[model samples]
Target chain A: MNAITARLSSFRRHLDPAVITAFACILLLLFLGSLYSRNFLSPEYLLQQLKVASFLGIIATGMMLVILLGQIDLSLPWVVTVGAMMSSAAAGFGHTGAMLAIPFGIFCGVLIGLVNGFGVAYLRIPSMIITLATNAVAQGLMVVYTGGFSPQDSASPTMRYLATGFIIPSIPNSVLCWIIVGAAAVFLMNRTGFGRSIYGIGNRERAAYLSGINTRRIVLTVFGISGGLAAFGGVLLAGYASKAAQSMGDAYLLPAIAAVVLGGTSILGGRGSYLGTVAGVLLITLLQSILSVMQMPEFGRQIIYGLVIIMMLLLYGRESLSR
Target chain B: MKQWRFWFVEHRGTLMALVIFVVMFLIYASNHPAGFGANMVQTASNKGVLLAFVAMAQSLVVITSGIDLSVGMVFTLTNCLASWLVVGSPAQVILGIIAVLAVGAVCGAINGCVVIYGRLQPIVATIATGAIYYGIALALRPFPGGTVNETIADALTGKLFNFIPASLVAMIAIVFVVWVPFSRSVAGRAAYAVGSSETAAYMSGVPIKRAKFFAYTLSGLLAGTGGLFLTFFTYTGEAAYASGNAYTLFSIASVVLGGVSLMGGKGSAIGAIFGALAFRTIGDLLFVFDFDPLWQPLFQGVVLLLAVSLSAFGLLRVRNRLDWFT
Candidate 1:
């Protein structure tokens, strides 16, 4: 009993402003959704929300890792779009092509991530500026290549199964995939040497380097991982939607960053948890769901989203000061 | 010769950007001599003047180790406000201009307060405020339609002196005004000091909060001025007008390309002005080449990357040479 209490105390102590606010947001959203629409409480609606949240959650997981490394990857939306496009195009080539497409998509993501890592880590440029530039490059290339159209195709049985098919007749395969990725990410972040090294480098690069850690390698690998995960999410999204559009990635940019920041991960790097990020993903999706159900205009929804993010940051900043 | 070399070294980044601009123009002129003449010059100059002001606004905050992601949004807000408020009379139009500047300043002050007093990160705070400002702009002009007086627009857009473009003259005048305070005042020096080392500056008795507040307020004022110029150029107001993605990229790119460090400290108003011109010239050159609009963002990305990389290389060289001399 005493041990359990102590464990709980430790967990409570670790609770950051992002986590608290995300929780409050989640509860508030659930409450508001229920009040506004009875359908929101139904299992079907909740499951749908979870399914959508899973897509963002998976990408946010990678975003959290990159942020944890004291860097950012703004090219995520385009990377995701590329992944979706590749997968859709591959599906058009038949089953063999579909099988090949998953790896190919992941490869594209890894390549871009590597370029970003190289520019930021080796070149020692600011990540924000570098990633912003790269994102533009990727998005521009996508626009030129796609000409502002969605690829018309459907995934193969395997891809479709991962996207729309169910694991337990009610739970979505996408949700399952999210759970597996989330669990693996949590374990990798908490119990792995690589994770410790990431935190170390994020906290103090010189100290980490002196301690014999290959800081550059760690940074590169984290970005690579982030890219791969984002690609996987895109593949899943394509399977679910049955088509991929040019600007599909634009919507993910803010949410991916929002999840990481709302999960209590410091944007400056090195201090956050994957579990918290997962919660944040759920919270944001819920908030959006509630707002949509309330029949708010698109602009109004965006305004509220921005305001909530600001409020969360303000609350977090105040808490940090008091501490 | 020594003085010339010293000037070149001090202004190398601006010089490089200018060279690039000239080379691009020459290439364009060679290909399409007819279109690249006075008409193109007028359009490009007008565009450059507007962006120069926006870039200057961004640089003011950036020099203090902060960024104003809301500048584009603030421009949109003021543009819409100008259209709505300037309809009554010429006096009202003047009042509208003052009101726009005041609103911009207040918006910037809010950012300053949140960042300094609330101790929030500048990027995150501005991003949030950007959303709010954009929302307000959208609410003001929901479907993108407003008008300015035709006479006022023509006068503002037309040449002032016989040979000189009014827009160019206005840009030059604004540059001079900004330069006086930034290059010749203690407050301006304090901005550099705070950006270079905030903690050290604070310890040395610089009122860090005041400096930060003033930087943001100046940034807002510049953004408002940019909006006013946009009205003169376009003669119409739309909520979504001038809120292009290119605005954000070009604003940052112009400053960085002109030798202003992203890490803060060590920049000039002249450099930012040149950077804006270079950016506008690049766009004109691309359009002359008949490059697809879809590729614009990609080109911008490459240009920004190259510019920043070149600037970083320059800084590195300076450091190495200093080390060698020491």
Candidate 2:
């Protein structure tokens, strides 16, 4: 009996409470939603929801990494915009631009991430301030690029295909993109030395350095990856929307952070899982859908999101305190 | 000489910020088409006070080593609430003012409860509360149409003695009424202690939680004051998401520029007020230079980044790298 109890406790340790809570919320939302609309339970409806979740999921993945490093990237909004704008603008060029469009967009994201990394890692600036400044700079650049008018370019065929296409019957191409990105994140975090170092740095930068982790380099690399991922999320969004618009990335910043925090990742860093973030993304997407179905106003949705975050923080804070 | 150097070093950040603000304002005034006239000064003061009030609110929490991202939202919510309440009659207006302040205090108290008792990180906790406050503001002023008592609005926002700006005077009154007493109080010292080092503060038998709570509550009140001023200036209430976000970001910039360390336990609201004024001047500078309005955000951002980066220079002088983390 003692052995059995120990095993169960071990299993519990493996299962994060935040993830469990998020899953339960998702299920509850789905059940409650279905009661209101019969179509809520339909495969098509859920699949569409999954596709939407994928965009947030991808952004949240990068957010989770930054959070794990005891840092944050507030530049997600502009970085995503850069990705979409660069790709779409490239598409307006000849075939070469079309071919290079996606890469160029991603490259913009990577470059921003590198800049973020440089500031945080070398200049030793706080990621929060650095990212915020970078975000402003990006906004300024984009504003100049668009020349205060609407972007004239539209999504390329490949971009549109990636956003709207389906791979395994019913599963969206965007979800496929998310899966690939998510898998890579999980592998990097779980299977590689780099992943462990992130946790170490998050847990304690000085200690991580003492342990020979090259803390600065890891911080730089992680920020870069985060930038790249945020940009990638933007690319998918543009594809889905069929074009890039001004300030298109604005909506994602809070939600991405919300998803990361909801997924059970510690805002203080050094502890969390991608699995929890996935659950968080799905839960938020479902909650949003349910709110829409209920014909709730945008303000109501914002209130609900805010209340839910505070409630979750309270819950998480309590358990840690008790221990 | 050593004592003088010590004093200079202690006040260096604040002094530097003050010097920067003075220089920027001088340059801005020199470039202005109308020069430093009463009209221009009044307008600038009116614009600066909005951010100044918010930055002052931010400084309270910042002093306690916590941040209040919700201050801007509180300002917005109170502005919306004021537009509705500050209209009816003289007595009604007085009541409206009290109610707006009360609402601000209550919002700050809520943030206090979450961060102190709930033990949540200030950033996330305030972000959540900020959103909630913004939601409330949106609900109150969905279409952005309301009226403030024009008499009161004019009295507060307009020039005093037909020479000095009434807004600047009111700002000074608030400084004396709110900031002076708070900084001199035990609770204020406790906040400073907590900001410098929480464990050390606790060990010193400071009422750490109480200090933090008061900091947050006062922050809300100041933000609410800002909101009331907004109503006075605009004579209407509009729950603008972008504006609220901008204020939040700019408040941080102002705080940093004012010589208040983001690390906490340093700087003064006076410095922050100057910082806000300087920041407002940057936009004016652009206008006077005939730059495209679109370039405002970009220029402001670049200037902010450069200003903030200056603070990082101290990191290089630290002998122990571990000091960087702290």
TM-score leader: 2
Tens-digit lDDT string for candidate 1 (A47-132): 99999999999899889998888777877988898778777777778668878877877787787788778777666677777777
The CA lDDT at A312 in model 1 is 82
Give per-residue CA lDDT, model 1, range B1-326, as digits (tens): 99999987867766766787778667766766465455556666787888888888888888888887788887887777777765567887778778877887787888888888878778767877877777787778787667776666666667765445778887788777765676567767888888888878878998777788888887888888887778767766777723634475578878876667777776765778788888777666666677877677677667767765553463365553223111
Off by over 4 Å in 2: A1-12, B1-7
| lDDT for A85 (candidate 1) | 79
Superposition error at A12 for model 2 (Å): 4.1
TM-score for every candidate vs. truth? 0.92, 0.97
Among incorrect, acceptable, medium and high, the docking class of model 2 is: medium
Reference contacts reproduced by model 1: 0.47
Interface RMSD for candidate number 1? 4.4
lDDT of 1 at A101: 75
Error of 2 at A30 (Å): 1.4
User: What TM-score does chain A reach in every model?
Assistant: 0.93, 0.95
lDDT of 1: 0.77
